[model samples]
Target: MKTIEIKGSFRKELGKKNSKLIRKEGYVPCVIYDKENNLHFQVHENSFQKLVYTPEAHLVKLLIDDQEINAILQDMQFHPVTDKIIHADFMKTYDHMPIVISIPVAITGDSVGVKAGGKLIVKRRHLKVKGLAEHLPENLTVDISELKINHSIKVGDLAYDNIELLDPKVTTVVSIASSRVALKTEGEEVAEEETTEEETAEDKDKEKKS
Candidate 1:
């Protein structure tokens, strides 16, 4: 797993007023919960963009007042209207401890279905997995070169050597779909629509006769 450096300050005061003041100064109030105790801290809001906005799961090296702890982002709070981050919470991780996190899914190779003019649809963009920090991966890749029309890759079909997938086995991850393959399908759809309209008109005529 890749690591990101986050430098912050340890906060001694705890209250809504103090938190509000910290936020007004463009800082986010954060907490790191460990097995022993909860540590309160504050980090600049601008410094959190790379960690929060990215799709990759990154191990955090939280540097607080010259002391560092290995942690992962557990939760965060945002303003309802503005969608700005207000607070963050982190969980301390150890070398031997296994933790669950969402890992991005990378689609590799052009699908055979796509070459047949069928649109490739990805049903799932990420999956939850559990593994130790050292064994975690940046992304899980799925080869779609052999996929044909109406074929799907499900969660049950995936296997990772280092991590355990927490998603349901039956869950679909990617597939190929779309009726708009060519002009033939379009003509068939138009004929179907015309038949439906004719049936509807006949029903209306029967109702009038009744």
Candidate 2:
């Protein structure tokens, strides 16, 4: 995994008022926790955009008071209305310790079913995986080049080294279904509406004649 360096300073005071003041200054209050200790610090809010927005998972290299540590983003707080990040939590990473992380799923290759007028449906955009910090992948790729109509790729179909998928093996990840399925359902709905309109029109015509 790639790492980005973030600089921070220790927060001497901890309170709601102090945290609000920190945000007002364009900084976000953050906490770093590990098996050893938990530390309170603050970092510039804008500096976290790359880490939060990217699809690839990353290990953060936090530099605090001349000390450096490798960590992963564990959680965050956001503004209720604007949805802007207000705070973040960093968890220390150790080489042998197992960690759970969600990795984006990337589909590769052309689907044979789509070429035959089928539609590709992706059910899961990401997969939860558990493994050692070093073994976790940045993203998982699924190949649909040979997918045929009515065929699906399930979680059990995936194979990776040193990592375990946390999702149920039977859960569907992607599938190629006939396009007619959607059109048939829509046609049924439209036919029902048309039948109702005809019935109403016939009733109105009889009432007028009476």
RMSD of each: 9.8, 11.0
lDDT of every predicted structure (CA atoms) = 0.90, 0.90
Local lDDT at 104 for model 1: 85
Tens digit per residue, CA lDDT, model 1, 72-138: 9989999999898999999998988998888889899998878777788889998999999999888
In order of listing, the candidates' clash counts read: 0, 0
Ten consecutive residues with minimal summed lDDT in candidate 2?
A: 180-189
How well does each candidate superpose onto the true structure, as a TM-score? 0.82, 0.80
| Candidate closest to the true structure, highest lDDT | 1
Summarize candidate 2's per-residue lDDT along 1-210 as a digit string, tens digits.
677899999999999999999999999999998888999999998889889988788788999998998888989999999887899999988877888778889899999878767799999999998888778778899999999988999999999999999999999999989788655755787999999999999999999999
lDDT of 1: 0.90
Off by over 4 Å in 2: 181-210
What is the Å distance of residue 11 in model 2 from its true position?
A: 1.1
